[model samples]
Target: MHVLIVGAGMSGVGTGVIAAAAGHTVTLVDRRPTVGGLWSPGGHYPLARLQETADTYRFPGHPFPSSVRDLPTAAELAEYVRSHAARGGLTEAHFRLSTDVRALRRVPPEEGGGWTATLVPVGGGGGGKEQLRADWVVVASGRESGPPTPMPPVKGLDSFRGRILSDRDTFGMGADELLAAAGVARPLDTTKAAAVPDAVGSTFNSGGASGDPPPPSPNSVVIVGYGKTAMDLAMTLSDGGATAHVVASRRHWRMPSTFFGFISSLPVLYSRAATVVMPSWAATTPAARALAGSLWPLSLAIRWLIVAIAYVSVLGRRDLTGPVPTAALDWFRQSFCMIPDGFRRRLAARRIVVHAPDGVATVAGPTSVRLTSGVVLPTTALLWCRGAEHRAGLSFLPAADVEALFAAGDGVRLYRHTVHPDVPRLAFVSAYNTFGFGTAVHLQATWLTEVWAGQLVLPPAAAQRAEVARVGAFKRDILSCNREPASVIMDRFYSFFDELCGDLSVEPVRVGGVAGWLRPLSPDWYAGVGAEARRASLGVTV
Candidate 1:
């Protein structure tokens, strides 16, 4: 089978390598010069919270140097993923680096049973967009592919002399472009394989990370949003001795880097067992009726147990809870902040002031921002780390084909977040899910490969959509508590993993058997996970 996989980052490469090893003809396309979409040294370097071992974040067999720190640096991660991609069964000939996927159109299976993809070379268009055919198309673009939403062009007097920074400016290509834009002589790519052009923080002073070249650091920074990127920027600025103030939209549940002081929260927050507590049939079937009504008492009991465990486990930071609704809880993370390294100390020391449950009301002056609280804070650099818009990633498809691809407005309404109901032979990797990023993408990639290869079969399109819609409703209800709906992450990774493994007649990761089930989901147990997934692909015994 001929397969076209988009994005050379972790998801794309992971999907491509395994599928290619399975004898599927695969082509991995990346617009960037190197791999590691988020971790790439040449792109926006948001710090992915990996409280677990580096093994949790990597593909099976492909891992960071064991000597790398528990909290590996971005350069370390980028290099690790790049080296792994370079070593995969899929060779350099299979990868089209520095290339962008312009659009995708699926050929009716009746016609030829494949999709026609359009590719455009990014920088120099000498390649002129050659069309290619593939039996399957996998969008491994991971999340955060789109450009960050531009900060509201405020009534700022443009005369205010300060660096106008956004996440793109702080952690993305715009960071490199800033130096070039200022005629600061953007650092040349000195190291070919080591230096990532888009992700290189060298000379950018984006942060004093790993002793890279030092770009000028901001003196005072007012950050927007509190996601991974915002926290990273805050840390970088504070490290540089800058006064960092975060204009947080809502207070959120924050856990120490460790869960309950010593427990690794990665397993709990995204692991298979911790993710899906409901019975398998309850998700999309009549069994769910008892979830709210007949089992209302049980539901309350379960919610109480989960919430109480969390409160006790994380030692219950009061800022995360109700009354007036301060910082909101992490919807998918189940209120586990998992942020370590003295974030609380920073808050207490007054170095970082979180003006939360209140957003930036307006840009008061050229160098100041008026909060919804009417407290005006001076700003040297205003960096918005708020997320990017959700893209369907099917913009390249023909309009009619695109219409069938979506049941939810602009989102991919695919079964298991992989194959669409109406659109056969198409799958997506790397949407935000409550699972280890590596494991989640690995499951989807291999499972879809198996499904396409006839090793497993999926449910009917209508049945799949029914379950998806129910889960979507569950996501809405979960976020309705905080009034933010669209982005709620349900703990569906392991549930779906179990289902896919069942279809393929393979064993899911056995959380119960590991360390007497004390740490079932820890990435350390992931050493054998890939072999199991591949075994499922081959219908081999464990």
Candidate 2:
């Protein structure tokens, strides 16, 4: 069987390795000259840390170094991915670099039963839109492939006198670009001082000029949105001695990675458990009484415990303390936990100032922004870290099936997150986003390859749908579990992982030693407590 995979990043490469090992002829495609997708150094967030662990990112047998924690740098991850491919005997012939998949259409199956794919080459001239028939087409092109979200038109935006930039344009720029753009320099580096050559040079003709008056450092920067990107940018600017302000419409919950000087990898003891216990307060509907009852108090107690321990153990310890008050816990959650405490302390002291309860109402200029609160902020640049949208690259398919399978709110429509229901020959290697459950792509690829090879038979559609629906119900119940006194979100995170593992027939492993056994058991106990609390608080029952 021949498989065509799009996107050479983690998902594409991971899928290729798994497919090749299964003895299937696979062709992986990506627009970049190298693999690793966002993991590439060229990616804007190249130095970013992984929010998960080594085991979570690597192939089953490819264990990451034990010392690695939090998030691996983009460079580290890229090297890790390349090494995995080589060690697995996966070759470059299997990858089509600098190739973009423009469209996908199905042809009659080669053996007269499955499907063949017609792939159009995007950039190179060699494959003149060749149709390489395949048994399956894996769309691994991730969420970031789409065009950068357009900046909302704001009144007076065109009239701003200062320079403005977007997140995509911030890549690879040095201090000189920053200084010039901010209007701090008297003579900009005309030969090579351009920030975004395409956008800046085309408009200002500044790149080739030998001598040009430097621009003034703008007063401030207005960052739009509040996801990881926004936080990261704010941190970067602060670190670079830039005082930047972030604007967010809502208060975001941040999970710290570790407690005191310890690593936060052990889920049983770490702060992440709080997330699982309480569903995201941001969820709209109320959670099922049973699940909600079990999670809320457990999460509350854990959060309190984390705070208490931090204050007692390291709040004043000079070695433990730095720029920010040292908490006995991982300060920032996600994959960046591996970054040293001193750095976080510095970040804290500098204080990445945040503006909450207010979002951008309009962009008056690149340097000026209006808040929903009616106040106006003067700025130099705007960074959008607005969340991502999921796009299924199945546009070529007839509308009906695409609607049924790829439509939003569709339940586990892809088989084990791989094969499509109606199109069995077509598999989607990386589509879903599982928070913190590392190695999702690897696990997905393994299960997909098995199903493709007839080694694992998936449950019938009805059963699969039933499981998906149950998981959905469970997720809803957990998320809406509480309204006030915010419930822990990590507890529910683990529950979701449990459901995923159960659905995939993968055994959930305890991360820590003897203490780890206690983690799984705590869910049931917490469920009972959460149910009682919900009944008391919301008068709800399940």
Number of the top candidate by lDDT?
A: 1
Q: Which 10-residue window of candidate 1 scores lowest in summed lDDT?
A: 200-209
Residue runs of model 1 more than 4 Å from their true location after superposition:
46-52, 61-63, 108-111, 150-162, 172-218, 259-336, 392-394, 399-411, 479-492, 509-516, 522-542
Candidate with maximal TM-score? 1
Candidate 2: where are CA atoms >4 Å away? Answer: 65-70, 108-127, 150-156, 161-165, 171-219, 260-351, 363-366, 392-402, 409-416, 419-423, 435-438, 473-513, 518-542
Tell me the alpha-carbon RMSD of every candidate: 8.4, 11.8
| lDDT, model 2 | 0.51
Cand. 1 TM to true fold: 0.78
Candidate 1 on 1-542: residue-level lDDT in tens?
99898888778887887787678898988888777776776566444445445756666556678789867777787777777667776678888888888887777767887888888898866668789888888877755676776666555536555566667655554333433322233253223222222111212111111222222233456787776567655654554455567766665655444545576655555533344434332342222345535765664455455555556653444333222122223333232345555554444434455655666666776676777767666667677776664454445656765676544553445566666666667777775534456666666676776666665656666788786777566555554432223333434545555555555565554544434223445434444544665564564321
